[model samples]
Target: MLRIHFSSGDLARTRIAEEPDPLWETVLSLQQLREKSREPVLDGWRRRRCARGGRALRTLSPLMPSRGYFPDFLTPAEGSGGLESGIDAVLSTPRRQLCGELELLADHNPLPSEVRRLAEGETGALRRLGRALRDYHASVLEPGWRDIASRIEGDRRHRTETQCRLGTEEMLRSFAPLMGWQSPVLCADYPVERDVHLQGRGLLLVPSYFCRRTPVALLDETLWPVLVYPARPLCSDTPAAPSARLAPLLGHTRAAVLQALQTPRTTSELARCTGVSVSSASEHATVLRRAGLVASTRQRHHVRHTLTQLGDHLLTGVQLGRIPPPSASRHHGRA
Candidate 1:
């Protein structure tokens, strides 16, 4: 069970208590904000942009919150009008938690490569935004899970197709003017290319609504909850999230092998620490490399093995015990 409270302003003083069953407070506190816009002129431009491509307004959709939670577009206040009155509720909550939940719920999501295209060289922005949404879910949402169940009943729940698209279009339109003026000089020639990347990447454009500075939110939309990050922030830099995926190996043997490999190592050294035969050690390395967990680089006559991102994740998981051991899963098999 988790508990959370929200307020219109002064978050710390708002009595917005949030608690998750496992106490994922660290994951829930980072917070996410977005660029809000109020320019109808920009909206008209975005409509033209949408028309240029076969992509309709229907293509721009909002990422919904998890199924069990209340639809963000709805409010606790009974008889509130649709959307307009519920705007704050729809936008509230940290962005990181939303992104994480969406990833957990959906089958496919954007990775670094997709993100780079959307960000236009703003990797740091994407990361911070993703993390912020995840944190919001963990910290601000209500504890009673069932409270949201009835509201989300079956097909017509939470985010309707139209509502979702409208929200997304509104955000994109807000950025149109800026995209025309502030974007790279070459961007004008390649408008469609830029548009595809930005919209595909979940970039939000807000007018001068939040501030006079440039406004946008690079968000993670795949996550069910949807994560967001502010475009032009007041802070020097936003907080970062701990890696979501873990390293691929576990146990003392794997740890020892990794530590010894400041430079890549031979199977013999791996076997010595692992207390296995050279043949057995070589087999383990082979499996790791095949899984993209380790890399092999040639050094003289010997082929040395070094851990890759997945391999490092295995090691981290072993240390943290947050993820299950590699051996426990059939995918890893016996090595």
Candidate 2:
């Protein structure tokens, strides 16, 4: 169990990361590759990654063992700047901290020869590691970045709605069944028992598309505390073709409304994009909302409409051509 102690100040400052942190995604994805368990969502990705495997696999394997510590420098706290920026951060890690973190890894498992050289601050090793990281991203993550970004954006929309409707405490409580939120403490299911004192630095809650089962947190307490948890699955196991299923049934206008809602948008904005009147767009949104495929919440003056989980699943199935026509058993429900 990992018990996170949150002072009142910490709670006030806690916020969700606005975008996916690429370095964290790389680290977690490496861990995913090391494990033999297969998830349906990763099937296509795994196949494509394995097919293109080469220096990325060979070079990164040593740094990420099947189990045990991976140097913290590999995933810097300043990763929001994107992949190249993150690689630069790794290359520029302070020598003492780099050696200390590497020593921690060495304590639990034998360091790969190249990694050992890296720990010694060898310039050549740093360049090679940077290359490996860049290659890994280009081969593994870049191809599907659009889908990944859409999914993350959808998740942020849902979370923002939750915060607007129920406040921060309830939003925190919604993270996962394994995570418990009590006054001043957020307890998480973890492999080992540990306590993290926030000390008013607060916590950054980052939602990840690849993270599975238990949430992840930084091992070193001195760094900015971050808790990475699994976001909702972006789509169903099978991909469906959208034009075939959705366009015919919903018509172009309604179909456009559903498609535009992968991210939140107000009716007027939806109207502008779909070239329909505001009233027409609102009617379409109303129908979608009544069908439980769209959710609309009034935020002060503007009402933002976002796709519900069912909406996303339906759209994904439609786009991929996997969803079947409505049946007695296929009732739409709230996300």
Q: Which candidate is the best by lDDT?
A: 2
Residues 58-132, candidate 1: write the lDDT tens digits: 111123221122122121121123222233332343455434444443444333443333224244544443443
Model 2 alpha-carbon drift over 4 Å, by segment: 37-52, 235-335
lDDT tens readout by residue for model 2, 1-335:
67888887987788888988888888777778678546433455677765345688788887776665677888897787788888999999988987899888888777678888888889999999888888888777777677666677767777767877887776675553335565567766577888999999988888887777778888989999989887765455434335335878987558767876775778666664444567987999999999999999999998899999889988886353445556688686322
User: Cα RMSDs of all predictions?
Assistant: 22.4, 13.7
Scored by lDDT, model 2 comes in at: 0.76
- lDDT against the true structure, each candidate: 0.32, 0.76
TM-score of 2: 0.67
What TM-scores do the predictions have?
0.20, 0.67
Q: What is the lDDT of residue 288 in candidate 2?
A: 96
| True lDDT of residue 318, candidate 2 | 39
Error of 2 at 322 (Å): 28
